[model samples]
Target: MDKQLLERVTQPLGHPSTSSSTTTGDTPGVNEPRRDYETGTGPSPQQRDAINQIFALLRYNYHNQFTKAFPDLEAVKTGKRLWLNLLAEYPADVLLKAAERAVKECTWLPNVHEIIVRCDLASSLGVPDSWNAYLEACRAPTPKREQRWSHPIVYLAGKASDWFFLANNIEEVAYPVYERNYAILLRRLLAGEALDLPMEKGLPDHVEHPLPRQEQQQRLRDLIADFDHPGRS
Candidate 1:
């Protein structure tokens, strides 16, 4: 979050852009986010540079508005530290992006929760909010593996919690299970892990055992009986 780390995060992941290549220019604004930060060692004292830059952007952009909100230098420092604590779990650069968006969108200086919400939005992207994610998992069509999910994390969470448990339980019981599973998946996502669902295994091209018709019927009956009283045998 410090200046050096901010510089590292702001740098393009690859070659410079054509405009930059064509002419010498000042570095991009400090508030510009490097999404690559998602893959970096998490927030530390150095990461405070990103937090500092966000405040700097707000102070400059919001002018007297930010000053009035903070009132004094001490207040500003306290506010920055408070934001860092509240938002430390997120990548520093993503928080900067959220700050940048707030500067654009807010008529007045936004609050810490507003900024945190933006960071969550940025982190989750296409994924729904936790409640909505739970609803999506609950309402997904049967043969759930074959259902088209908005994101694999949703399916992954539902699978981890057991689709039948989710379907049978009340939200008070089910939601926490889904939320916990979703949170684990969300962190994995933020850490840049792929969350693609596993493909459903299908029948082999040829049967390993060609049962006689009567035997196959008898086996089906036995399987249904076992399902009805799984503890029996």
Candidate 2:
């Protein structure tokens, strides 16, 4: 919102503007110097300016970055993995749609993190990727076409532990959805959550579930359902 501060902050450090009409040379027009946001910060002015610069860069390069990174279906697919963990926080349809887009449009290949981030985001949104081995644990009777993270409370906790271990083994980190769900599990555990644990973790406390099992699924389902569908009970 503050224009002058933005200008001051955005002014290039070494390179001066090369505009023909403007003689200030300090200006940031067509050949003008680009601001350095990563340096100098004792006063709040620097931080505020940094925020402004971040917004500007985001605004100007938002779509462009995506465009450059995702030129074809492969790129989208490659990039899609980054969002995998992120997808766990949302609805299944939403995640599937995102996956579909990536699977369809990206030209460049993405890293495992990309797929995992989407999964994480999905989990954060309440959508998790379920393999047949995973979904069988959801309490979905028949294990429907679309796999969900958890169905019941007992197996869910155990499954979460399993998944967390798997994630660790895979060396995944910071994927929002998975992290969110994982946190949720811990919070409930700390609260002495009531439910079953299907896994064979041999947890000493009746409070915390160590491994994922069928009983854990039931407990997790019940616990999550209480929060997810408060009106159902």
Choose the strongest candidate by lDDT: 1
Please write out the lDDT profile of model 1 over residues 3-40, one tens digit for every residue: 46434333322222223121112324312222122232
lDDT at position 141, candidate 1: 91
What TM-score would every model get versus the actual structure?
A: 0.42, 0.19
TM-score of 2: 0.19
Worst 10 residues of 1 by lDDT: 15-24
Off by over 4 Å in 2: 1-61, 72-129, 133-233
Candidate 1 residue runs with Cα over 4 Å from true position? 1-124, 202-233
For all candidates in order, the CA lDDT equals: 0.67, 0.37
Clashes of each: 7, 91
Sequence-dependent TM-score of model 1: 0.42
Q: Residue 26 in model 1: shift from native, Å?
A: 49
Candidate 1 clashes between residue pairs 3 or more apart in a chain or in different chains: 1-46, 1-47, 1-48, 1-49, 1-50, 2-46, 2-49
